[model samples]
Target: MSEPTAPQVPAIPTARRQALRQHLMNEVTRPARRPQRMLVLAPAAAVLAVVVAAGVIAQPWAPRSAPLIVPVHQGEHVGAPLLLNQMAVAAADTPPPGEGEYVYIRSRVAVAELGDGPARLGPAYEREIWIPRYERGDGLLRQPFLELPVIGVIPDRTTLPDMPPNAEVVDLPGDPDELLAKLHRERDERGRGSSRDGAAFTAIGDLLRESLLPPPTSATLYRAAARIAGVEVVRGVTDAAGRRGIAVARTEQGRRDEWIFDERTFEYLGERSYLVADTADGPAGTVLATAAVLRRAVVPERGQRP
Candidate 1:
């Protein structure tokens, strides 16, 4: 019998490829908020062939099996504004990534999974990503396989195309008030969250997570977050890696999302989300997710470390 040949796949255009990369990255990096219908990534066979040939499997969006729930440690609400000001000063002191370098971030994250039974959080997993300083350069993402099977084989690495910068992170004005207004407008247009204030807070955290922002821009983000209503301070909170820090948080609907910072230095540490009121997903004070940033630095290449 003759050997079978591989199917030919058409080359994806630059614009389309960029859009695909953005969609995949957003799905991979963002935390799942609630139990919802999963959107299966079943593109045309030709596109799927190209993606698989590039050593990247579209992550399955199936409902995850419930794991153990982490307990939430509550704290008082005072000095949130003052703490944000201190964080803004610290963020401004950090230098931005140089041109032609990659921003490397190593983190430990445990995301909550909700099934038919109850909501639970999975074990913490280490995730590393290399983002190019320029939008034209390729990037890399490395993490262990989840419990669920992906295409019947486990994948530990994914090669990502050059992703365009987020407009809110890259183009917003430095003035805090103007920046906040723009975020609110964009959030409303996208219809992201239940309230405008909650959407703005989530947007700021998303910008901080995987992207490297300019020093002034980072400072502006913290200042803008401070302006959002319902922001409060939570003390003595621990991240996924068990690092203790203070947090600035906001409660919307039934969940509270917190951005943790070093108590003394006011440096960014990580973030966590938990329930404040009992719901069908889980009980009050049930932790939904937790993440801790272990290291961040500028590297010369995609796979290089500091």
Candidate 2:
């Protein structure tokens, strides 16, 4: 009180006062840590983008049912009908040209060139067939039961065996309903005959599944390959007059096989088995069987007469 010296100021601690001022300055001047400067939103954005990308990679190019209906079975459609119409069976005692298996049936047969075409008939080199010598009641050819008509289109050199003038050609007995009525009628009327044997190239070609084929045979495969390649069937078999079936197909493997059927019925006619070579006239394969063992028969006309 006395001296009023330096007007006594309230006691202030220098260190405390300095610290309080510094704290205030820091709170006012620093930039709030810039919201932690963190790019956390960037990571969330990246996660969302990744999710969108995953959904776009899972689908097919086309519908699904468009691949199976393209290849139609036109080959059989074209040839089978004609084949059924003209097909017939013939017989063989010994082998025909190659290796024939059949030995004895009811009818008899001999190799005779009914026609003089250039094409080789059946699977064997020597062309032969299973014709009928009997006749039925199908009406008469040219004359009224005067001459026994030929059972097959092709012909054979038969002893004519005192044939009843009109007997069915039993070369291929496998046929069922094919030429039966005609055969019986011909035999009954003329004693023997040859009616359904000769077939033109268009006809045979119509039946041929192209030409040379691959192994693992099946009608389906043959028709497919044949249509794809534009191949042709045997042409110009000597028109000398021999009724027989054709070994219509060949394998790249050399297998050559044909079937001879009964004109009356579509029986499992005689079969020709042999092989072909890229070159050479000699048979590269062999003939397996003939009229000796005919399969069942085939009937085409449906409920036609006998």
List TM-score per model, in order. Answer: 0.74, 0.20
State each model's C-alpha RMSD to the native. 9.8, 42.8
TM-score of 1: 0.74
Candidate no. 2 TM-score: 0.20
Best by TM-score: 1
lDDT of each: 0.64, 0.23
> Where does candidate 1 stray beyond 4 Å?
1-26, 29-78, 95-100, 147-154, 165-168
Instruction: Give lDDT: candidate 1, residue 207.
Output: 63
Q: lDDT tens digits, residues 13-43, model 2?
A: 6675455344322221211111121101111
